[model samples]
Target: MRATRLNLMRAFAALVIVTLLAGCGFKLRGSNGSYRMPFHTIFLGVPDTSALGTELKRNLRAADDVVVLDKAEGADVQLVVISETRGRQILSLNNLGRVREYLLTYTFNFRVMDAKGAELLPATEITLKRSMEFNEQEVLAKEAEANLLYRDMQSDLVQQILRRLAAMKAPAPQASVPAK
Candidate 1:
């Protein structure tokens, strides 16, 4: 009988602990206040219909937890990133007028929002830069390499989003006020 009573007491304590945790803002998602909703429907907004968009969609699909939606009306969440490609000067030519090195940079302005219109995560901007030695004879090969670099950059961007989302905290329940 005493053993049964002790087991019951332990169960009761566990229930209480769970209730308290629920009252607080603790969730399974991450440390930050982010909801772990099964956000299957996602709306992606990009500046233009480019390879980046295609690659981003493919990576998100591979995640299996997210579904890229065709429209924004009923999306569980939204991901918007304005990407701009720019030519960067990494190295200069010598006195003989021979090119040295160059870099290509792509900057993305990104954000993710929940369905309730709350800013789950504010817009965070990040840039991906790739540098390569200048070779006038192999410009085509370099351009091909640039595409591969962009693909890697897309993967990195996805990882950044996942990290930020994972670190979000869930909203805490409000305490009821007694009548005055």
Candidate 2:
């Protein structure tokens, strides 16, 4: 009888926990899914060979409602990558003047336009930075780690671009005036 009562109490407690979680509107990560893009077809102005460009292409392709075009012609929207740059700087130095830490930065400038060459979204810049500790003994490993971090940053930037695109509101149609 005691064991049965203990099991019943544990089950009741688990039920209460689940009910509380459900009532609080808890949602799992990525449950929101892909955001809707403003335009149906979009042209990526960046080169396909670049890392950011390639990843952006892949991500845009994942959205079911958005079509990534090869050229700017006849596209509903054109995304122009004005500039992209990557840099590293020494953050800290050791007693012997050796580098003890480094900061890696990636910056991207981009904008959106319509088929008629009117700007839809003005130029925007996104910058991401990361710091890493350096040790001469782990040169190769540190280099690999830095490369991985850069790739991760690129992925994050792609997501940011997508979210920005999703947030964009389509411009209202201009009214035409009749000539007197």
* TM-score leader: 2
TM-score of each: 0.62, 0.82
Q: Pick the lDDT winner.
A: 2
- Score candidate 2 by lDDT: 0.88
RMSD of each: 14.5, 4.7
Off by over 4 Å in 2: 1-15, 19-33, 171-180
Query: What does candidate 1 score in Cα RMSD to the true structure?
Result: 14.5
Candidate 1 lDDT by residue in tens digits, 60-167: 676646678888767767776645464566566856797777776767777777665666668787787778677778989977887777678776766666666545
